[model samples]
Target: MRARKTTMLALTAGALTAGLAAGVAAPATATTSVLVKPGKARPGQNVTLQVPECETDGFATSDAFAGSAALDGAEEVEGRAGLATIGAHTPPGTYQILAHCGDVNAVGQIVVLPGTAPSPRPTPHGAADAGFGGGAGGVNVVLLGAGGVLLAGAAVARSRRRDDVTA
Candidate 1:
């Protein structure tokens, strides 16, 4: 009986530790290079260039660009992003996109698919207007903690009940 209780306590501690560790969120790593959304795009389609490592306003150059797209507004590193329109006349091929920050340079590419016609550019809107983050990528720490506590409590209660019956 003594050995059984000891084993149960050890198992409970292990379970609780594992649960807490799982609940703890990992730190986000900053991007050190440019990232292009929609790696494959049709001509005249707008592609977003993300330069999370950039500190100042910059621009992106590409043969596919209507012209060089300006990366401006919000000097914060994470906020460094811009829109580059794929030229209607850009040939169907993979084009290298080079983004230039203050002193940082990052490269990415966009592939223009063949045969898509250019459409009118839609009005740009704020991210909030997109209504994103609908409770996505969230960890329910409070619920997890509560569940762990309840599990530990139940284990202790069952062990005590066994003791009471034996006594």
Candidate 2:
């Protein structure tokens, strides 16, 4: 009985080693993450850029994201890849970023038009009322219109004369 017990213990140990040799252990899974640099943000505004982790679709966050440094509460892309970034209200112009993995590029654009200036009320014949210049353009326009009308009338008279001759 003692020999049988020892043999059982050795068999158990050999079986465990053989199981490991046969690759029954879990495979090594590596997690790869890319570092995303936040793009240009407004002075008083906030921003966030998602940092993508390793995924089957190449490299990038599952969903586009953005945030300030230390992306704890910011948007995160996990278990995904080949996605764009997310951001809003960032400065007033084009913004660009170099993606770490060169898989997806991040970019942004903002146009900050200057605030409207209080326009002065226009007065007819006054300095502020001089729309796109002075009376020069107005006279030119009137002369052109008169010339066109005269030309059209002359054309109609000539057509009538031709008709009369034909008749």
Clashes of each: 0, 6
lDDT score for residue 135 of model 1 = 44
Which segments of candidate 2 are over 4 A away from where they belong? 1-15, 18-27, 39-83, 87-167
For each candidate in turn, the TM-score is: 0.49, 0.22
TM-score of 1: 0.49
After superposing candidate 1 on the true structure, give the runs of residues whose Cα lies further than 4 Å from its correct spot. 1-32, 75-79, 117-167
How far out, in Å, is residue 124 in model 2? 36
**Candidate 2 collision pairs:** 47-67, 48-66, 48-67, 49-66, 49-67, 50-65
lDDT by residue for model 2 (1-167), tens: 99999999999999999989877565544433333333433333333334343223332222123432232221245533232334332334544433232233333332222232234477666345555556434456786799899999999999999999999
lDDT for 116 (candidate 1)? 70
